[model samples]
Target chain A: MPEPKALPFSARDATCPFDPAAELYELQEREGLPRVPVPSPIMGEFEAVELTRYTDAKDAMSDPRLQMGFVFDPEQPRTMMNQPGNLLNYNGADHRRLRRMLTSAFTVKRIRGLLPKIEEIVDSRLDALEAAGPGADIVHEFSTPIPTLVICELLGVPYEDRESFQRRAKIGLDVNTTREEQIANLAEMDAYMGRLVAEHRRSPGDNLLGSVVRDFGDQLTEDELTGIGNMLLVAGHETTASMLSSGVALLLQNPDQLAVVRDDPEAVGDAVEELLRYCSPAIALPREAAEDMVVNGQWIEKGERVVTSLLVANRRIPGAEGDLDVLDVRRTPAPHVTFGYGPHQCLGQQLARAELRVALPALFKRFPTLALGVPEDEVDYRTTALVFAVNKLPVTW
Target chain B: MTLKVEVDEQRCVSAGHCVTSAPDVFDQRDDDGVVHLLDGAPPERRHEQVREAALLCPAAAILLRERDGSA
Candidate 1:
């Protein structure tokens, strides 16, 4: 087989943090699906077909023959991947089975029921932000805690353990972290989740994990419960937290759009959707071809990997309205694969949307004159993580 | 101009796009969280919003049939 060509693909542009690297857009214009070298800390460097167009992305993601389980090497000792209930570790029937177990936990109705609690969390965080006065790191003071606390409450994880879990979650998502560090962090989190699962086994509470123990305890193994807890714990907060911080920075840059999101209560939902499309938090969703297939006219052999760039796919030309690359909160709702597409699309999307819909507008309403504490150029954007986010958004009202 | 709407519960992922678009016409069952059609034939004025709701459904589970037999 001929060697795959290496393409320059970075998650975000240094010049424009919100946009994908210009080279990716150029590649999309020329070749919609190009084979490129993707480096992983666990598996080192390998070739994967990169899908950049919106239609092609949806097609590849939705194709059952393309499986997510093959993305990781069989030899890898990653605990999360080896575990049973880690949804990303399985495909087809196994994936559907595991996914069905948790579906009700994140349903729109269930999430809406949590709104009062979410509002309380948002309000308390806003109160803390107010007490901190101006020049606080919005990332640490505001963005991180709301989701952290909410997810903790949902999963029945003790609020006191958040700092440790949050740290591990950060290490887990960072692409630049060494494989050893990733394994160590995953091990620590697994141990922690094991204890939580054991506690729930003794006495189930009202939260998701507790409910699982109560409802499906006999059907599930201890490892499965731990894996489920860890997946929800990490995925529950990290993506939404990244969106919160980065969304703030994006809104801060576009003041007029910020005004629309803040002033019009009815517009918050659409604004959140526009922000999800524009920001494109989770960068790429990786899958592997289980069989020989042609996607967007590009042939792929069995066992070859395919990675969909959510950033580029969502930003494809002729967006919902006006330019796809630009951030306009007023744009009509356009379908973007930010949460991904197909059967394995984000299960927590409704929950994430609920948090964003409430958190963004509430933050802006509480601090109407919010602006960046540092100059625009100096804001640190996390470039090497699976999820795109700001390192620290220093802000002042 | 009443509109007929039906939801295939098996296909629904509970993305909530339908309910968000037209809360009055669509909701989710409290138990499994699948889409529950609150109004099979909504009023004339709500047809456009119901159509938008069907379009927004990621699962394509929501089917709308207009009174004229047009979907």
Candidate 2:
């Protein structure tokens, strides 16, 4: 690499849990796009030009020239990341074909229709939290279960199958798991989904996966259905669970901010957006450049990788109002890259928004005096994982 | 004022941002959730929302052009 910048991509400083490493912001503030060596658990360490500016990150994310699913060889040792139906492993036409089949289930109107069910799920979780009483971990009691239950219902996994689904949900989120362990866990996941998809094929249920099988069965193959089932099940629940947990922690730390979210019904939508921006839960996975491209007047070479730091790029959005360090619950929602941009933008964003919009405010309303069960300093944040999350959030209200 | 609005269904990932931002001007298919432009030339009153929809679109699939430039 020509530049002296080497970055530990997803490491979060305990002292400042909300931000990426300080060097990342500096690279953004510096003049030209810097080709920094970034270490990846999946791809090992490689030189990737950082897209830290808001415009550059947004534009490049959607740019056809910058693609995903090409970085790692799928069959070299096929893992869940690129299994046949996983959206993360496909680009262009192939990506569109797979994604469009699932889009109807996640449309904004579809999510709107789902509000009552989501509310029911949130309320049930709240009841569980109250039953657990004081000294309950929100991760287990509130945040985690809400999304998982909702996703399970959406995917139409039989009640019996969810235990298996939930058990392996965190496998990909652990930073220290060995690659062999990941492959084994993924293999287990593949087989499980395979069986589920097989059942869907025989007699499609009313759930999302069942509906996909019901509606588009002939167009998709067995492996593709299995990949879609697993990816949707995993990505759908895991991302929201982390965001919910982290947003609760962020709000609990800032009582004034939490007050706004709790008291104002109108503020919930905007509050969730701010949470998505301030927390920026998921990191943008690297994309391989198929050809040389210039973003923000800087050129990236063909075959080089590009990493857009969502945490940094989100706060640095040029016209976004208010201070970056402060989490404003009432801030007008900005065009943050939290759900990403372009073709591969998150498929379940509307669904995630609906979950957060309902869950966060409901948690506070139900437990008005919610407080951290452990001391603030004792809270654990899993920064090294693909999704930044609070591992365990013990709460008492 | 006439505000022209168009949606590239091919580029749209059906994030429903346009529908959320400007429901009058944009809608999604019942099947695949692809976007459809409800108003090719939205009236003056709906111009601001139409612009917001275009801005918020994740796919950048919504295209907008202003005609009758004078306000």
Q: Report the lDDT tens digits of candidate 2 across residue range A135-239.
A: 889998877788888888999876566667777867765554667877788889888888989998999998998899988899999988988988888888888
State the lDDT of candidate 1 residue by residue for B1-71, as single tens digits.
Answer: 55788888877777777887889999877666678899988988888889888876766788987766563
Which residue runs of candidate 1 sit more than 4 Å off their true CA positions?
A1-10, A70-76, A317-319, B1-6, B39-44, B63-71
- Report how closely model 2 matches the true complex, as a DockQ value: 0.87
Count: clashes, candidate 1: 0
Candidate 1: what lDDT? 0.82
What is the alpha-carbon interface RMSD for each candidate? 1.7, 0.7
Name the TM-score of chain A in model 1: 0.95
Number of the top DockQ candidate: 2
Model 2 ranges off by over 4 Å: A1-7, A71-75, B68-71
Model 2's CAPRI class is: high
Q: Fnat per model, in the order given?
A: 0.31, 0.85
* Clash pairs for candidate 1: none
TM-score of each: 0.92, 0.95
